[model samples]
Target chain A: MDAGLIFYGSAIFLMVMGVFIAITGRHLIKILLGIDVFDTGLNLLIVSFGYINGGTAPIFSKYPNIFKNVVDPVPQALVLTAIVIGVAEMAMGLAIVMQIKEKFGTCNIAKLKELKW
Target chain B: MIRRLIALLVSLYLGYILYSFVYVHFPFGERPLRGVAAHYVENGIKEEGATNIVTSIVTLYRGFDTLGEVTVLFLAATGLGLILAGMKREEEEKPEPTLIMETVTKHLFPLVLLFGSYIFIHGHLTPGGGFPAGVVIATGYFMMFIAQRSFTPSEYLLSATESFAGTLYVIVGLLGLALAFSFLDNVMPLGIPNRVFSAGIIPVIYIIIGFKVGSEMTGILLHLKEA
Candidate 1:
């Protein structure tokens, strides 16, 4: 009956869907996309846990007198760094994919099993 | 088919475990703040001179983690460059951009740049900060890449800006160590909160982060473009 339950549900759904995609998808790009979805779901879960029922943002200017009602800010700070690092990691994965395509001429996981060039 | 079904089952089980674990420990939206979050919310503004507690936590309380995070990004970009090195591209005929895309990009590019600058400049006092602002600046360059036919980011400019910003970040951290209690400590005067000039070393560190992230992101985008 709680509204927060809906966010929790969505986060779980995204994580499950990402895992499904990452495990079953043959294309390298699809797997990478799954990884991204997984990261996003984890981020959502963190931010959601930091939420208070009626609390405002932790910014002092927005709610000067909301000393007792501000939501947890540690999660928000951690999520910020996580999101940016995800971008860097995903970019690196794509770069490796590009190299694989250059040498192996395929993006499918099933076809990229050769060890030697 | 069996593999897909097995994967689905396994992931569903894992997801259930994760969800239940979180639900049991903290419940959803009902838990009260404790420990560090409480401390930061109470005295973060007064001690850090920044209206945004998240900024204070990221730049002051956990500055070392942020330093490592930035280094991770830099290393990722460097590794990306190294992985894609020495691939010669045959010059292909450039295609012209659509009229609407060209017109829109031309008009939107400068606005995006200005908005990105605004976000980073007032990071200590705003909701958004260096990372989002840096990505926005890179998005502007990305627009240029798509709109212009023969356009490429200048290697010299990007490297210079990235190096300068990264070096400044280290220097600021060292200054904190030399004058204050430890590395990345807030040593400078904490001006009045809710103002642009407040939050000593917080804004400075964020600006440096902004420039470094912007230049690195732009380079990554340009590097990944098909030649």
Candidate 2:
């Protein structure tokens, strides 16, 4: 019922939803979107892992004493790197999809099963 | 129907496992700061002279990792460029931008660029940092693309800026190794905290990262658009 449970619950829900979408989606672009959703959920879970009951941000510009109740900075730093990498990955994935469509003449996963052998 | 049912079952099972794991090990909001995180929160300012602990961690405490991250980003962009090359160029007709869009972009473009620079310049003292600032700068470029169909950014300019920034970043890190204790160390004088130029090498490195990321992202956007 508390904030922690809510954060964890939503993160898990997003992860499950993303997995379902990835499993069931037919289009290549749809599958990519599902993967992005999963990425978002994982990021949410990581940030939440560093959460404290009422901790503030880890900045010390204004309130120096807040470090006593500051949330963990390591996870935040990790998420920062993850987000930039995610953008790069998304761009690469979309580029590959474009190439696939160009060569195969379709974006449907079922139609491009020529390599199933 | 079967695929959907199987997917549902898999998702449900995965969700149950994750939920139980969270419930058992990580009781929400009660994780005490320990080990490295504790040290960072407590002494990060003293060591790095940056008000933003996360910024200090990203650019200084774990700076080597950030260098590797930047290399990965560059590789991804280069790979995308390689993949998109040699495609059959199709001349698709495009419509002109609306009057409102053109006018808004004309007025807003400079402000966005200024804001992005501000973000990266003040990274040590504020919440925003290089990545977000670079994205914002790229967004400005994206807006220009949207407003003008003929707006093709010069490939030379983008690559030049990106390479220059990246090289400068390495040079700064090398300087740190030569002058200070290690690579990417704070060789510059740790100026007054809460100021724009505080945190020694942190702000300089962030500025380099900002330009590098901005140009790289803009190049990616251009490739996707051209493709």
DockQ of 2: 0.83
Per prediction, the TM-score for chain B is 0.95, 0.97
After superposition, candidate 2 runs with Cα above 4 Å error: A63-67
Give the lowest summed-lDDT range of ten residues in model 1 chain A.
A60-69
- lDDT string for model 2 (B73-139, tens) is 9999999999999876689777878999888998999999999999999999889888999999999
Residues A1-117, candidate 2, lDDT per residue (tens digit)? 788678988998899999999889999999999989988998999999999877889998673455488898999999998998899899999999999999888999999978842
How do the residues B96-189 of candidate 1 rate in per-residue lDDT, one tens digit apiece?
Answer: 7998988888899899999998999899988988888999999999999989776787978998999899889989999989998699999989
Once superposed on the true structure, which residue ranges of model 1 sit more than 4 Å away at CA? A62-66
Q: Each prediction's TM-score against the native? A: 0.96, 0.97
lDDT of 2 at A63: 38
Assess the local accuracy of residue A101 in candidate 1 as a C-alpha lDDT between 0 and 100. 84
Candidate 1: residue B77 lDDT (0-100): 83
DockQ of each: 0.79, 0.83
